[model samples]
Target: DQQVKQNSPSLSVQEGRISILNCDYTNSMFDYFLWYKKYPAEGPTFLISISSIKDKNEDGRFTVFLNKSAKHLSLHIVPSQPGDSAVYFCAASVHAGGTSYGKLTFGQGTILTVHP
Candidate 1:
């Protein structure tokens, strides 16, 4: 079974608008949640992350919210611009013994299209 899932395959938003991406997970052991943005033929770039201890985390125009009880998380981008158009992915990892080795379980990904 897939531990992580992105229910929406794609989303479209006008420029200077808000974009929300949702993700869900089944593993309760996951403590670290992260969001990543990827472009065509490029590696995913880390966006924001929230630990299980935090309900929300924000970085510039991006914000990530996590609900541990519900095993769900969402990423929100305010004033979405054309440059924000890309595939957004949610990842979860368990830092076992502080030697995670950078292993992460990623969602299928949601494509966000920003219209000018």
Candidate 2:
């Protein structure tokens, strides 16, 4: 069964507007959340991430929030721009011995379109 899911297939936002992308996970074992953004031909690049211990993490214009009780997480982009348009994938993993490698599970990506 797919543990991580992005219910919305796509989201459209206007430039300078706030864009929120959401995700949900069914696995309670997951303790780390990661968000990746992929361009047309390139690979998905890591955007922002949050540990289950934290409710929110921010990096410049990108922010990621995790709600452990709800098993939900979201990525927010302020002032969405054309360059911010991409496929966003949410991935989760269980932290083991301070390492989370080889246990990552990804959700189906959501397409984000920012119109100028």
Worst 10 residues of 2 by lDDT: 95-104
Give model 1's TM-score versus the native structure: 0.95
Candidate 1, residue 10: the lDDT equals: 99
Q: Which residue pairs show collisions in model 2?
A: none
Report every candidate's CA lDDT. Answer: 0.94, 0.94
**lDDT tens per residue, model 2, 16-96:** 999999999999989889999999999999998899999999999999989889999999999799999999999999887
Q: Tell how far residue 109 is off in model 1, in angstroms.
A: 0.4
